[model samples]
Target: MHVQGVDGAEESNDGSFVDLRRSQAGAFTRTQAMRCGISDKVLGRGVRARQLQRIHPGVYVDFTGPLPWETRVWCALLACGPGTALTGPTALRKYGVDGDWRDDRIHLAVPHTRRLDRKSSVVVSRHRDLPAILHRTRRPLTVRIEVALLLTAGAHRDVSRRAAVLLDACRQRRTTPHRILAELPALPSLAGRSTLRRILADASDGVQSFLEHAYLRRVERAHGLPHARRQVRATTEQGVVYRDTEYEPYGVIVELDGQAGHADSISRWRDMTRDNAAATSGKVTLRFGYQLVSDPCSAAIQVAAALQHRGWPGRPRRCSPACRL
Candidate 1:
């Protein structure tokens, strides 16, 4: 990307602004910086004038960068090499995986065979399929995990939502099968794949993903209403309905509202039509989004009510206004 000079002034030919303006082959290393005659004083000037922003060791970005923090993110990936990607939470933030959630680190995943240096802000890792996640977007290419997940999107919204949470959890370093399973209900309308089940199985322990599996599990999975099948195929007049969750003979369908359901025009229409069809049937469907699954109380209340309507008892009653936490 081109550089923006002081107050939108055109760039000067002087060597001083050259480093800050040029397209980098990769993340700048200490050795390269020293060779190019970059000093702490010059870096300080760049920072003051907003010409450059530092990220992970010697990596820096020019004010004229293409994407926000793009330079540093690319730098981390290039410096780490071909097998590396800005995975987990770093990828989530970079790719807008979760809107408005500020993360504190640059998570880089390398091949298990690669070695890394001790660097703050850059959390390097390894994976057998690190290359699977990176993709080129806009002018510069970006490494994305979700793109890989979307490669085969047949699992439905519930699966995708869980995968996003699972991705977040892996980014946050909170990886566990049970926890990932717990977080799954919160991601509404998210398409899923068998790949997601594999991703959950391979969660990391010390490295951050993008979510908190512990929180999701304790609140959702542990006390969640039981359903025999996570995804059930129901052949109704509405064509073919892929039910991610079911309340059995009572016909309680819990749909996970995902990004596509809310964002994509076709998906939204399909969802609306499906909901209308569901209502026409004897089925009672309670739809929950990311927030409801995160808490599950609203979902629980609705599920319990549906069950009660079908003669199931001993369920927790709704909390009184004063007793609400």
Candidate 2:
């Protein structure tokens, strides 16, 4: 007999008792099973028959085959009880946000006032003022994308890595930096507020990568250089090429070459071809790498000089004491 709950969970026709398994990735809790008309006797019967496998104290997988990573996550959430939602990398992954997901454990956020059983594969975090809509929306039992990113940011101490995670989340999900900034005040304190605020400001200024962002913060903004247009696309014989940063009025193109993309011969050749094309078009190209982005003062001075030669009429300011611009 098919049954339904007020929460909209339904049962399958095969008399599995708990239909939550279908929606919950083949995992369900004892409370949900009982709510779907499964008695303790029947539950024990299913366990004995191998139709159900206990994963947590009160959670079971409806199937016997090897469980996938997502199923394990689902099992963790179900075991954590209500008012809990996936957070951090787990929730971010659901939103198609890129990050490290091989941690082999699930992260769930519950109300700070509530307590849950400790499980080795599950990390239960307590949050004050857990946003209600994160779990109430169509993407039930999981935090929102921005919330997940914010939470993930709070866990990371390295500023560059944190910026990469947040920026990549924005890039992959096509979420606006303004939306993230607007929500920053309401989020629980995890990341350093001042640092996050700085990164977001740089992001709003059109910095896209860790390197590009560093150049903006440490070189351009810090040294008072002209704000260059970012990720500018230009058409060439090789189709289209994207300049990392560009001063269109001065015809100065700055390319940030990360090792991963510029390491191969093919990539190097393409970069050279694009640089030559820019030169032919009367544009001056300047390329920077991780090292330049790391210690950007010298590179900033060179770019400043190039811009001056192209009639920029502005001098880059010194960023710190004992530093030359």
Candidate 3:
């Protein structure tokens, strides 16, 4: 005979706990064994068949058949006892991590002090309460991977914070360049603080972040475009001088016009001489400088005409108004 508090909520037949598992449903009191038509003996029988998975001491699922990974996370959470959340990789996948969410075993948050029995499918990690910087909703999306990143970000500085700030902001905003200032944990290290400031200042609201916004801004400007940063390397041609923006895409070799590259002639000469040696063969070259791209229209028009000349598609998307292509 189960000595239990008789919760008055209506229970469905076959003892399937209905009010549980829904994100926002719960009754304050217990259920009566007699009212639910479930006896202690019958409850024990269901528990053994791998049907009713017990989440914790009190809660049990009267499983009809199989459960999904996310459902397993919820059930594991229920079994792991109270005050638990499925925060981190679990949350991030829902937020936008861009991969298969079901591939991971469900992650659950127990107290920092609790020792959970590890199972094959479930991976457990200890966590203190989330920092004041990280807020929570009724969302169980944090998942295990990102929560670990946030923990590393707390230490501040190093590649992790640089990587974390960008990643966390992306997760939080579903976009890049989230206001990283508010979320910075209080870090006392001077280098760490300075790094945080640099990282935040550099964060971009652009369509992309990993592309280095400042560098892209420089490239996108209506001014002296340099070699397409990492993509193309340039050198001075003995017979011809071309602007950095001008590229022969087929044989990609950039032309470095040192005279107008920067005001510092001595430093400019040094850079150009080095660039000349670097562009041997086997590389596409882009050649452009201050004056060529200073007028944005000139640069775009030149590029389009050149690409079309090279049989690249220069035509705009042609669509009748009715079709909306």
Candidate 4:
């Protein structure tokens, strides 16, 4: 039976073979070649002639040069058989989120019942409800941004990395927390739903970094502190400033200092000026560093005191048995 070649032309099938090889990053499967009207004899001949390199049982790579990482992802998709698409960090990376994570194995999501052997360069994640989780992108085969972030949270081992994925995906991809939250009910299998929910809640409140997120979870939410407005913007002579978390009703602002210190003179001046501006506006600012954020109990106590001092009638409840409220 004559098969449809890469190019639509019939007589020029030979030329189309070459075009197809080049189009797919010099990688194709035996099935693809056969479907393209290329005979097994031609495939064998190409491999024997050193023009094609067998990268997997049925997959061949054109010996053009070093195979790019993206091409490898494509090859992994092909090798995983049909009904497979890129997911997790592999998909999120394309959306410009979490550049620091590097995994050698390409992440693919396939139907749950589709049993497949593992490949050295591929990691297969089975989703029982893949059809619901998958999203059609320009590539036509990728998990949605929220799905990718959720899967990534499961795949990553580090707590900070897990936390950062949510914040970074929202900030970098310009996706809203509400958009992510909307996907939760439809998600069939969730690895860390509570953590994801917390991150989404923090994101909705404008928590930006991992540390700030920790403060929101550990200090504020845990101890039942007053809900604070996050990333509150104010115009200042130095420039516009965003308060990390603000208790506007009580006129209290909480600033979370990152791991990196504001040692530079200009940054220090800007911070001082921002604090002065808040004070001038009759708002008191409470700043916490990495150490304080780590000790959530103490941070909550301080915040409770600050709110109470500002006429908050409610007392902060103990977050744990050991927490001295």
Candidate 5:
């Protein structure tokens, strides 16, 4: 028996079928096609004719070959049924968060009360407040960037990894610490809530990366070093440059190099030129990489030494039993 059309008219007469397919990146659920007045026999014919590609059981795409990222996303949503939204890193990427947030599996969230079957390359989660977090007006349906950040952050077991998610979201200008802070009350049971709050506070203070957050907490605060100004803007021969951490009164600047290395010869030269310009302006630049920052005590010692040499009277305090400072 043919499924009844949604508007009591065949999709062919109304053009809803084509419109629905286009809106979902050429992917549509079998149920969706049926609601548009397409039959099982018609779908079988389309599949046999190589005009439709089955993605996940009921999900079908108009094109064959490798599926595009957008098509994969649509297929996941269609397979999950209604009220499902893109969540975690998948949602963050949709909101334009740059860097390493991409996932091979499409992450989705539905209302906690609904139980859905699993699909390949799809991770489905249940959220009690899914409706509140979901962006209803947006296509492909996604959780708000703030909620997505929190969800993504909560999924990580490591505190640093969680901090990285929140920081990268803000650093890339996809979301703000304040917006994320506003969404925190909705997820009171989120993992590492206290740590998440602290990181958000640090982000509000212009700490833009996990490395910067680590430096602020482990090195500066732990060692009783003066709080350094973060993202300090300075006009130099290289034009405008922002220093990661600046002790302006002490004439000392700390540059946290998060890159594995100078990415290229141009990056190396740019760094060298910036340091030289700082030197010419009588400012001392202390560079620290991930390895150096891993030992917070050592990093603090160096920073404290630089501050002391620039006429600060304070000495670095030992943070732990193993701390050499």
Candidate 6:
């Protein structure tokens, strides 16, 4: 038997070993090694010689030093054994939905019948319909984006965080509200199901983030303000851009900024350009960040003022007894 060592050139007279390590980011499970015909003695010798590094009990990577995030994910999956796939925030990250939705520990989903002892660095979730949700063809094995979003949202206790997971997934174009809604029925017991449904309804109308949802529910609906067209597309000198909320008839646009603020100078510049273009077109642009949005009543009042200034004769009603609107 011929075994090609991690070095790619060195060969050993052992059981035949296929080079499956490369596809898994140079990581493979002990069982995988054995399946490839690498004996326990050869594996132990590779580890002893520092050609293989143990990440988890049964997972080994070919190289030494720090492991990349992708490599770590592969190791985690291998450690959990077969029939397991990435889920929740870990899967969200893999799907390229950026933001605060990330977990330090690897999140995985397995069949309900599968039981494994918990590891500190891994979060295991059991699903009765795991097979239905798994993206079997995807490398690194992950749940579908819709499943990942729903699972991630269900794991969060905070309504805002939960909404953010679903919204961000759509905002980043990883999945759509319709896709999520279609998958919702599969997990009837999901936490915050009603809230998720409501959010998805609004999302269908272009609500893309928790802040936008807040502005819709608290500022617009609660205060009896005019329904603004959301995620309105407009062509500008800075190319095509989408407005968060546009009261087209009233010539007022409301921009909801996240707490994290502009990512860089280019983003800030683009925002300024967009606002300037709106002003040049005789439209009033009102920008609100986390602080202002947190006080929805106050935000409503400001938007109402802008709308009224732009010929919207409707008066904003107070949302509650304490509302200053």
Top of the candidates by TM-score: 5
Tell me the tens digit of each residue's lDDT in model 1 across 140-223: 334444442332122235553544555553454433454544534433433553556555653432212222232134223444
Q: Which residue pairs collide, candidate 6? A: none
- Top model by lDDT, which number? 5
Q: Against the unseen true structure, what C-alpha lDDT does each candidate score?
A: 0.52, 0.77, 0.44, 0.78, 0.84, 0.82
Candidate 4, superposed: residue stretches over 4 Å from native: 1-19, 34-52, 64-66, 156-161, 260-273, 305-318
TM-score ranking from best candidate downward? 5, 6, 2, 4, 3, 1
TM-score of 4: 0.79
Which scores higher on lDDT, 2 or 5? 5
Please give the TM-score that candidate 6 achieves against the real structure: 0.88
Clashing residue pairs in all predictions, respectively, total 29, 2, 28, 0, 0, 0
lDDT of 5 by residue, 30-132 (tens): 8877877677887787777776788988988887788988889999988888888999888877777875765678999989998987788899989887888
2 or 6, which is superior by TM-score? Answer: 6
Model 6 stretches with alpha carbons more than 4 Å out: 1-18, 236-239, 259-265
TM-score to true structure, per model:
0.43, 0.83, 0.44, 0.79, 0.91, 0.88
Every model: Cα RMSD to truth: 11.4, 4.6, 17.5, 4.8, 3.7, 3.5
Rank candidates by lDDT, best first: 5, 6, 4, 2, 1, 3
TM-score of 3: 0.44
Assess candidate 3 and give its lDDT. 0.44
